[model samples]
Target: MGNLSRKKKKNKKEKQKEKTKNNLIDLQMDQENEKIQKTIKIITLGTGESGKSTFLKQLSILYSTGFEESSRELYASTIQKNLIHYIKILLRAAHSLGIKMQEENIRLSRSFFAFDDLTTQSLQAIIQLWSDPGLKEAYERRSEFQLPDMSKYFLDDAERIGKSDYLPTDQDILNCRIPTTGVNELNIVVDDLPWVVVDVGGQRSERRKWIHHFDGVTLVVYVVALSEYDQRLFEDQTVNRMLESLDLFAKTINNECFENKNCVVLFNKDDIFRKKIKEIPLKTCFPNFTGENDYQSTCKFIQEKFDKIGRNKKRVIFYHFTCATDTESMRAVFDVVSSTILQNQLNVGGYL
Candidate 1:
């Protein structure tokens, strides 16, 4: 009887030990799952010149180290080239508009375009040509033709940019226009959460590559340029830019692959939009819109168009007005973005 009693106690103890071992294994797995949940994967999507790359640059400035010296040199070179290209566009537009330049200025423009490289003499000519009433007149009608929205900002700083030792400032870097080609990935840790951000080219030709990145996307950040309402597509001038953006957004937001993903629609270029709205009516692009042309009403009108498209989707969405070149504004905007993402995780885990 004693032997039997001892065996029973031993078996009970062994069973308890086995249960504890199982519990530890379960706990470890739970911890690991929690860690995995903390990582956020984001993909930025938009039409060409819609401020996608600028948003990525802001992320780097905010979360990671800023650009290195060599990178700045490259941007500086691009900026110089951009300056020359912008002026040439203005000159051509001026000619088309029947705005005459002085004989000397015309000669300067012709010679300036022929130079294979940017030089001090060319910079002086640019400064002189920019002051011409005819060029300024053509610039006012820029909506009739394609030009980067940052043209005036950079042009106004012509003297500073023309210096031989000019280095692009952080603001300059943010405003610079560089088309993203294939795919660029940035890994940043924000608020103790690992973040993987992927930026793809927004051009129509580069959109085919976007499908591969869609598989594991945790969030889709659809950016739109509010100022594009008065512009046309560079690829196909016959099509209005804002209309193109809306069509693209509708397809992207309602995509079957993203039915379960969260999305954020950023009506970007608010600075330019605010100014343009006063001059051009919102109805130009959205003819169906009946709201007031003021900033608040116009912005809401545009947002509703996007909201209507995603109303039936199974995922949550957030919207914000953003000026990607403004770091302070972006800081506040992204804070909300991060909170929304975290809250979503809580809801998924039934912790809310």
Candidate 2:
């Protein structure tokens, strides 16, 4: 009986030691997890020029100090270069389409390629060409070719931007066109949580790099150019831009890596979409789209399309109609987004 009692006591002591070891291991794991969660990883995905970069810039303007004077000047130079390129694209498209430019405007178009800088003469010429009916027609057919959504915005401000002492405004910086080549990241602290926002190139060729950034991604901000409903992809003109974005969103959410991760879809460029629906019907891309050619109806229709893609997913998806260039609007929108992210993180961490 004494020997049996000793054996039982030894077993109980060993079990207690084992239990203490497990508790320490779990405590260490929780600490490591807390450290990992300290920095929230956010990934932005969408088709090229869907305002992904613009959204990042907005976050900087809202959360951090905005662009410095030197940065604004750099963007001014880029804007000038982009303006020249914009007109050149229009001119090329008009020529290819056999759209007749006025004889004087034709001369102006040819001269555009030679002058890299936007001078007073060039700015005047740009204004003159913008008035040309042929270029205007090319602008209308912009979807068939590659054109930045901000082409008109920059073109309209050509004279102001060409001034000798001109500096790019916040809006100009927001609307500037610079293709994200690889992965671009923004580190900012929102509501005391460190956030690392990863923006990858949304072009077909650049999408392959996205998977490398998928690890530890807490949230996905999938931007979609709402105005692109009638547009075609830059890489392949046969593919509708909106459809490409939809296909990408489908794959992104269904990817095993992104399973159960919350996603926020920003139906970006609402300003353009609201105006575009009046001119181009959404049915041009989605033929089965029976919704009226109105802003609310079309937006709902597009949201539903994305919603249908994510309906079966266990994760929550939120949608917002965003005009990325509008600072105040985006700030308000991101406020809600950041709060949702915080709550979702807390719930997932079992802190709720």
Query: How large an RMSD does model 2 have?
Result: 7.0
How many residue pairs collide in each prediction?
0, 0
Per-residue lDDT of model 1, residues 173-270, tens digit only: 99999999999888999877788899999999999898898876778899999888989999998999988998998888778888888888889999
> For model 2, how does the per-residue alpha-carbon lDDT over 34-78 read when each residue is reduced to its tens digit?
867677888999999999999999988988888999999999899
TM-score, cand. 2: 0.87
Model 2 / residue 350 / CA error / Å: 3.7
lDDT of each structure? 0.88, 0.87
| Clash list (residue pairs), candidate 2 | none
> Model 1: runs farther than 4 Å from truth?
1-37, 346-352
Q: Tell me, what's the RMSD of every candidate?
A: 6.2, 7.0
TM-score of every candidate = 0.88, 0.87
